[model samples]
Target: MRVASLMNVLGRGWLLAERALQVFHSTARETRALKFNYPKGTFEAWAYMTCMETVSAILSQVSQVTFEDMTSSLLLIRASLWEYGLKKLYKLGEICQLVPTSNAPDENQINRITSGITQQSAGGDSEDQGRLLVATLMSKQQFTSKYLELGEMVIGAFKHAGRKRTACSVGLDMAKFHVELGQIEEAERLLSDMCSLYSPENWTIFSANTISLLAE
Candidate 1:
């Protein structure tokens, strides 16, 4: 359940979702009370279902969807960014957030995994469900802007459990996340302060040059 792998599944899931969208033409496809195995569903299952739901609900009445005839739906974009649920989907986000940064996959890896999917896409305005995938990849704190609060919680949890090593790894992940978003100074500060905490197995995979350049 690493972030990267989950995101890749989401990216692929969105591509598969396009097939479902082709079912309706010019009219919205309404799904009422679609009973899913809630909370019991695996992450992959939930992710795909969510992707399908969000896309269908957000852009309905497409006027047409001709998968065979790309020209048929001139207004339709093959790939797009969907901002579904806004900040409302917290439970799902929290479940994902608790996964340790050490185990979670970062966004860059997700991009690499989806590169082939992008190359094969049938030309759309943007990739479908891009933001949704990214949001899922976000740390719970980062996703919800509860960083300071989450930081304290994490520190307290790890310290109470006598897991100083685990604390360092989470801190490193926070630094790396900032780096991914181009927040170099913040990342560097975190890394430097927690330098002694880094073990051979836990430093971020991002290049030293990239880290150094950005930290400056």
Candidate 2:
């Protein structure tokens, strides 16, 4: 049936994203070890650049599907920032070593690199796909703002669809992201706002999770 086929396609996208995440994590660990041992050298620089490429691939794969998946979007944002940091290190190593300048990435270059993946997707909003592809190339400050904006949009979509609990859950996740970024006041305000949506008869888990996060 059409429903089964759609689910299969979605599941395939998620599976690819998940597998990419695993590879990225493993590559990151190896690169970290290389950095710790060599500090600043050709091998370390090479390892780091490779690791970043893997991270970029994960973002590319995720964007090939729906940007509506909060986990994939969050991971891409996090990995984007991490890539920024790693790139700085790579540049620093370039001064002392013949680091691979050819591998240096710019926004346009990354966009081109991911264009094939974006073209492969048969579903999801084109506008949202554009936003996600843009997100993968953004710097830390840019991605943080963009992601928060996306979280709000996704929450609105959930609310409009009468998925109040899902919306509240996403709001909590966004608040947690704020906390992770050390925006404590923003996190507190978000949690407070989300509280107004929860009641005794609904979203009980949201209240408990919000309270637990606030307590932290």
Candidate 3:
């Protein structure tokens, strides 16, 4: 019910934002009027996107959510963040510091997302990307779980960007993630999928640089 309520609230915010965009703009006298409601609405879609004050209130409620529900909510929140662009994200980071800011302003969205997930996950089995809120919400699952899912999403987008090998490499990383969790069987499955998606020969070559388990 909490998830549903949150979803409803998010949907209503989006609708209001859409209506705001249609709030009407015109040129009067010596001025041009333009209504850009969706922009703010997008950012406002999730109160916590920039709401440090309500973080406790909302998270207090979400803290009790199941891992499945919590991950779903987090995905929705992340989507809202992306809609606002990385520039705004960096700004939010300035305040809460939980949401990350892109240091390389020139990097594409996929790269930025990948870097965030990598930096956070590398710190240990943490899907929260080094943030207490994320860690708590996702505390039940293996830390690498959410990171892997997000990595795959980025890889899919990268494939459309014309870097097939780079895209496939993420799957290898997914396999590595599984290995770290001591899920050898799961890791092997991912590696096998990567080989089928890419090339057996290339997988063999790429296998050398990563952890030895891939070689096994």
Candidate 4:
């Protein structure tokens, strides 16, 4: 899949490249969920993240990017980060003797630990995963700045391309992430920017949920 994605990317087949990445990500998920025939941890979670990052790097090579492209890329990267952090936390638990070592770690235990990490971020949804991932990184209190820098770089790219709605959406997610880390002020600042991007006609359930989170 890696080679396929790279070949497609070189051929300027962006959609095909993304499809390969999706297949790789799905395989990784199935492996983690014990549905795949591969051994547990056969597919490292960071591999998907790295692939997404690589695609993001070459996005500039495309002369034009549509809304769908930007949104899809955003979702792909978000999932990558979530899986990256989730697997990292589980491995860390094993190393620290906080979790039992087994071929397949308990999913419920992972969920419980994730819940305990951040109250407002509890759930299995992508947004929840994103916030949980950020919270986990922040709780470690290491390389927080680097993560933030990468996030801002992505967000800035969207904004620079005049994809305000997409940029605001990602920024809102990033804010919720900060909220999980108890960075209320920074979260509010980002949330404020989100509000301006929404109108009554264009407001969506996601937008409403973000606002509700801010209200809380």
Whose lDDT is greatest here? 4
lDDT of 4: 0.52
Residue 148 displacement in candidate 4 (angstroms) = 2.3
Q: What is the C-alpha local distance difference test score of candidate 1?
A: 0.41
Candidate 2 displacement at residue 129 in angstroms? 5.5
Residue-wise C-alpha lDDT for candidate 4, range 59-89, written one tens digit per residue: 5455486545655565454444433433444
Q: Is candidate 1 or candidate 2 better by lDDT?
A: 2
What's the candidate order when arranged by decreasing lDDT?
4, 2, 1, 3
Q: Compared with the true structure, what per-residue lDDT tens digits does model 1 show for residues 27-135?
A: 1222223443323213332333343343443234332644343332221322221111222233234335423334453445444423433443332213454344444
Local distance difference test, each candidate: 0.41, 0.51, 0.41, 0.52
Q: For each candidate, give its TM-score against the true structure.
A: 0.29, 0.42, 0.34, 0.48
Q: Please tell me which model should have the higher TM-score, number 1 or number 4.
A: 4
Model 4 lDDT at residue 136: 40
Each model's Cα RMSD: 18.8, 12.3, 14.1, 11.0
Off by over 4 Å in 3: 1-142, 200-204, 207-215
Instruction: Identify the superior model by lDDT, candidate 2 or candidate 3.
Output: 2
Task: For candidate 2, write residues 54-160 as lDDT tens digits.
Answer: 33444455566564554644544334334333443334323332232223435453444345435543444333444453454444455456456656755665555
Runs off by more than 4 Å, candidate 4: 1-16, 29-44, 56-139, 157-169, 204-212
Indicate whether candidate 3 or candidate 4 has the larger lDDT: 4
